[model samples]
Target chain A: MADSVDTGRPAPRTSTHSLVVEAIENRILSGELGVGDMLPPERQLAEQLGVSRAAAREAIRVLESHGVLESHVGSGARAGTFITSMPTAALSRFLKLHVSLNNFDLDEVVQTRLILEVESAAMAARRQDPEILQRMGEELAAMDDTDLDREDFGDADTRFHVALARGGGNRLFADMTQAIRESLRAPLLDGYRAHEDWSGLRETLQHQHRELLAAVAAGDAERASQLAAEHIHTSYQVLPADSGGSRRQGNRTAAGGV
Target chain B: MADSVDTGRPAPRTSTHSLVVEAIENRILSGELGVGDMLPPERQLAEQLGVSRAAAREAIRVLESHGVLESHVGSGARAGTFITSMPTAALSRFLKLHVSLNNFDLDEVVQTRLILEVESAAMAARRQDPEILQRMGEELAAMDDTDLDREDFGDADTRFHVALARGGGNRLFADMTQAIRESLRAPLLDGYRAHEDWSGLRETLQHQHRELLAAVAAGDAERASQLAAEHIHTSYQVLPADSGGSRRQGNRTAAGGV
Candidate 1:
């Protein structure tokens, strides 16, 4: 197992800034430091840690990028760096890049999505909360309206699935599910745009959403799961084949295509 | 849906350094910049990007932390910064921190693992790759042997599961599954150490592993999935009551508790 901290510097490796960042990160992870807690002044931290100011500043810069730290502009107390809770955006960015880099293929992405959504749908069925369910209903309603565009439908569709994931009562899983689903928004929309029969596809999706909502509301876990899996498979079957391919091969951020 | 890039501001609302970094990151993600490509020299980049050398340097440092860019030390052809790929370690670190910060709760973590591992276990069974199977078999045998320490058994046990995750065709899922499982390594070992009947627990796990392997060998997807789920659930049941809860209260980093 990897150690909590890389304690063994077997050889001259990483860099001074990296090591400094790790040290501070360990403290945050260990709860010695916490959200809202201010870090020592750069010079003080450097002196205490026996590192140069440049190293300390670089470490701070790293943490700042990760959203683990925030800097306030002022003199005294508000001036220093403070620990901050990273929002889901950080996770989204990381996962997006990872996927774009071919860290996971389209098949893998689809399969992973299937597994998460199936379980999430099942859980949502078992513990259907009215508030969240209502939100989902709104998404379905939005899709059904005559003036709704494909992009709008796509965004609503994402929110609908995300609501189901959140209903599953797992934060990490929900965030991941949200990330994956959101990442596919552009590509899925591109496929939707390319569809010759938009009304037919929209009708099918609407029917599926209604069925899914009914299952969840009725607390039918098995039916919810089955519908969810079917919904995903049927929808993807209609997606433009080229849109599902790696968008990273060209000079477009996956987001642009989405 | 959020736009690909925030081009509203000529520069970002915050530090110029951060804006430069975000722009570069956006470029990289968009595939405008590919691996092995060299970045412009600091002075030229700063001037072209309408930022200072200090800001350019800071941007480089931030990207370096994420393993997106690397800088050379010597005054040679390779002395400039270049885009590079990061190993799964960077992803793991991001996930671990997010987990620690309660970006996702216990239920989320468990469900995410369930999604990844169940699929992975089923695939591993179907593939029946000799090397992975052999590694898993070693762990199973180690668990069965009475003289093995709790720590050793736990380590082996993690390996068995990790091997199964890697067997899945999806590297991203495997990397994520391995990272989440590894994060729990310390706590699982602590639970093993605290067990009143270590032999009994080991016996149970061994039986589960064998059954899981048998399912995989026979290409019984349903059985492999069921076995994997039960294995995780039973192991969680045996863990100390405080195992998951202890994380939020404190003890973020491993202090060698087990």
Candidate 2:
């Protein structure tokens, strides 16, 4: 019988550390190595894979960073490394970086933010709790402060949207909503800084925030969704058109270099 | 500095590796670790932190797995580790695994998918090029083949939706759409096999697909978005209402284990 056609490509002429790292990731993703499964001893695994112990050790470290594996300090068999399962924060950080890389343009990001926040606002309107609404109120109050700097106002604005998303009562939606919104913080601040009418802009934003919070508080799903979408689109429209915010940032930089 | 006050805790036994990982992540999130910056050398970093070389090496490996670090190997001073960015796929994988760990329930997944796909379909209707529309048509055709197995049909179904997202002309929206849809592949297939009326269900799905494509082809954004949302909701409604189709599989396994 033919040898399973070697599903992996031949390792490039790189360090052995790279090869070992890839092998371990393959095993984890393919489900051959699952959560809570103890890895074989380091020396034995190194021997089986025909690599050095240093390479195997490096592979362990890589997986540990991704939260794919955990190790305890001990001797004997119990000291072996085991697979771990972590929260989506690891993934969220990865996405945040990708967004910063300008793989997607500003228009695209704005459009996406429109979709997510509109949906989140609608859901929040329909199923919001008192605590979340109170949080939105606080953020609005902070934005209304006349002494607030552009940076502080921008931070408050971000918090307000994040609160609205959390009020939607869906963790996945809330997390993605927060991630995408937070990803825009830098650019939004840049826009705010470039504005000569910072006070006027802050006043306008605060007005919108109060209206949106009231709509959501009253469970006005249709109104809330429309307002959220309009707010996002309008903000993007108002930003300085000359500066290419997307391209000026880092480019490419995919997680795996793809 | 009063020796940092220790809070009267048990000697503050945190590992040096863990501390390094957090510090690095903090820098990245705060925009200090921009792409193309070189990380401190392993030996130098170890001494700077007052930690062993092994700890520093481990921290480096972890960041590498998250796609935050890349390395160059050379005989001279040119060799060093570099900070890098990751791709959306990495985030998607993290989201998928997070969902698997029950961080978000099945209903949340379904609802999030509905919100994303509907907006994506609407965008695709307005912006998709002829080539993208053609690829979507091909995916639909693949699903129409009666001889296709459940796996291939599910894959084709996913591709059809993914193609629509890609055509939406918004990279962030498309990435989010693709991630949610791709994550649903396994559970959706499992749900498909659980139904007794497989042939009838398949026919219904095919009809919906045809209707959706027709709507897209006609450039009816409103109709396409509405149809896509209904399509997603209808599928979930068909699945066993208990804990979704996967729950049944899980219960059976639990009973067998007992």
Task: Provide per-model DockQ scores.
Answer: 0.32, 0.27
Q: For candidate 1 chain A, which ten residues in a row score worst on lDDT?
A: A1-10
What docking class should model 2 receive?
A: acceptable
- Model 2 chain A TM-score equals 0.70
Best by TM-score: 1
At residue B3, what lDDT does model 1 achieve? Answer: 17
Q: Write one digit per residue (lDDT tens) for candidate 1, span A48-80.
A: 989999888888887876767776666754566
Best by DockQ: 1
Model 2 chain B weakest lDDT span, ten residues long: B249-258
Cα misplacement distance, residue B141 of candidate 1 (Å): 5.3
User: What residue runs in model 1 are displaced by over 4 Å at the alpha carbon?
Assistant: A1-13, A75-80, A244-258, B1-13, B41-44, B70-72, B75-80, B138-152, B244-258
Native-contact fraction for each model? Answer: 0.32, 0.36
User: Residue B250 in model 1: shift from native, Å?
Assistant: 13
User: Local error of candidate 1 at B114, Å?
Assistant: 2.1
**How far is A140's C-alpha from truth in model 1 (Å)?**
2.6
